[model samples]
Target chain A: MTLYFMTFILFCIGMYALVVKKNLVKKIIGLVIIENAVNLFLILVGFRFDAEAPILEEGMGKMVAFVDPLPQAMILTSIVIGLGVVALLVAIAIRIYEKYGTFDISQIRELRG
Target chain B: MIELHIILFFMILAALIAVEMRGLLNSVIALGAVGMGLVLQFLLLRAPDLAIVQLVVEILILILLIRATVKLDRPSESTLKENWAYVLCLLLFAGVFLWFGYRALEGLPLFGAPEMNVSDYYISNAMEQTGAANIVTSILLDFRAYDTLGEVTVLFTSIVGAIAVLRKIGRKQ
Candidate 1:
């Protein structure tokens, strides 16, 4: 229960950064933070006390305890997706910097508008 | 549980530093620390596959962000003071979200005892059905192969978009 709340708070911190920060790179950092927070929460949902990794050993008994594998699989895909999004975002940021000559979104806003 | 608690605390702290720090370079390094803490948390939580992927992805992201920061960042660039009105509005929204989110979270199964109606089937029969020792791999590559394909498409599309966006010239214009 507490852990879940902590995860929520972590997400809120990310939201805070995304909303409050004026720097483009800071906003991207916030975005990644939010992603990591959600990923942690998903894996946390599947965690089991005293459970081993989900891999099956050659002679392991059927009754052996293993953590849930579903969220792990989902997180694998999410991690890769996150990499792509971050790459694209940074690329965009670089271009913005090249055009506006600043990483501050406020300056870019005033310049463009 | 205690170990998870410590790592979670570490992650939150690092994330806070990453967001609130003044130096862009320092903030990026703090974000890297946050990712490392996440990798540790994943391993502690028995998600070896995620840990490995996360570690690799974190390295790539750090390299990319550092390159952007070093080459493009100007020392004169400083964060502007955010409008207090906007900050207050955002706080109000976040408060409402947390109140409702807490209620929604109350109905979920407890932390360590998830409702595994679907995963139960996957765990038991995945090995024999897919001939894979790792249930996660089996599920990723077998039961949900279509999802994997979509994921690949997304990756490819994003990479292509990034490459196109970063190109020096577009259509000779």
Candidate 2:
């Protein structure tokens, strides 16, 4: 319960940064924070107390309990997807910097065309 | 349990610093700290696979962000009063949003007591069917191979898009 509450707070902080910050890099940072918080929430859902990792070991009984593997598998894909997103976002930010000569959103508000 | 709480608290503190810090490079480093704390939490949660992937991905992200920040000669600055107003509005919105989220979260299974009906089947039969020791690997590579394929496609597309955006010129003109 407490863990979920803390995760929620983490997510809210990210939202605050994303909405309130004017710098493009800061906004990217907020996106990263939000993604990580959601991933943590997924893992928290799959977690079980006193469970072993989901690996089959020789001589281990079939009934031995293991932490859920479904979310872990899904999160593996998600982590890679996050990398791709961050890379593209950073590239776009750099392009914006090149054209406008600034990373501040306020200064870059005008459209050239 | 206590350690988990400590790390979560530390992560939140680092995120605040990352968002509020004046120096761009410092803020990026603080974000890296949050990633490291997340890696630690993954380890503590019995997910070594996630911990490893997160560590590697985090290193790449930090490097990219640091490079981007270091290349800029001037610092970013914004007006203080406007930022404060935004923060106050955000706080009011967050308070309401969090109350609703709390109610939604109440219906979920408690921490460390997840219902694993589906995964139980995977754990018991995955080894014999897939001949793989790691259930996660088998599920990802065997049962969910199509999803993995889609994920790879997404990565490839994004990388190509990034390259396209970073080119010296977008058009022949």
Candidate 3:
């Protein structure tokens, strides 16, 4: 579907930012974008037209059409992982700024071989 | 469907602006807008649980980024040739991945027709097995509880790592 292709395009945009940006914070932002794009893609894969949320009601007999919930659960874990990774990245960025006194990757070349 | 497409378009635009913007703070804000667009898309796609999680996580990330970058000066720009190299590398990477991804997509079951026997079993028996009305919750807490446990461990480890890293910086100052 067009929608799924569009999500891939978004993923590519994130990849572009990640590779092309020089600022450390911008790189982290790009990483976050890539994480979100994957989550969106997974959720989109699980969606069904006209299907309700996968919540069963009391005495609602024979639920016919509920969207898949497995991908939703997996994505929940992924979103949480993204949060942790971002937090760690920001902390590291702060430390890198403290040591190097700059946020530009080009200028912080101590680690370059 | 058209509405969903419109939102996806806006999301892509926001992503572009976020990537291309000059100011770091403005780019972060744009990224937040992209997150909001994703939240809306999740809601529209019948994933309320993901929508809620995304909303809270996005706000928290925005706060963290703002706090980290608040006192820093403007980032210096890289050289033009380096930028071109970066762009070319990404284009090549994207082209390869896109081709593989499209091929993979064709092999996948069509949209709205999930063919997983595991999911079917969960859908049919989750209520009786877990007594949870929400299938997502049941799957998360009851069926695949070990995965949740592992996820919690990962979160705990990251928190510890962050605190340790930040604490070192404080002591050095």
Identify the leading candidate in terms of DockQ.
1
lDDT of 2: 0.90
Q: What is the TM-score of chain B alone in each candidate?
A: 0.95, 0.92, 0.91
Superposed Cα deviation of residue B170, candidate 3 (Å): 9.1
Say which prediction, candidate 1 or candidate 3, comes out ahead on DockQ. 1
Report how far off residue A104 is in candidate 2 (Å). 0.6
Give one digit per residue, the lDDT tens place, for model 2 in B1-173.
Answer: 89989999999999999989887888899999999999999999989999999999999999989878887837435332246888889999999988998999899999899998888888878987999998999989998899999999999999999999988775553
How good is the docking of model 2, as DockQ?
0.80
Give the residue spans of candidate 3 off by over 4 A: A110-113, B75-82, B168-173
Tens digits of per-residue lDDT for model 1 on A8-81?
A: 88899899999989999999999999999999999999999888999998889989888989989988999999
In terms of lDDT, the poorest run of 10 residues in model 2 chain B is: B73-82
TM-score of chain A of 1: 0.97
Candidate 2 local lDDT, residue A40: 93
Estimate every model's Cα lDDT from 0 to 1: 0.90, 0.90, 0.87
Evaluate residue A55 in candidate 3 and report its C-alpha lDDT on the 0 to 100 scale.
86
Proportion of true contacts reproduced by candidate 3: 0.77
- Residues A2-105 of candidate 2: C-alpha lDDT, one tens digit per residue: 89889999999899889998888899999999999999989988999999988778999867789999999999999999999999999999988888888887
**Model 1, C-alpha of B154: deviation from truth (Å):** 0.5
Q: Please provide TM-scores, in order, for all candidate models, with all chains considered together.
A: 0.97, 0.95, 0.94
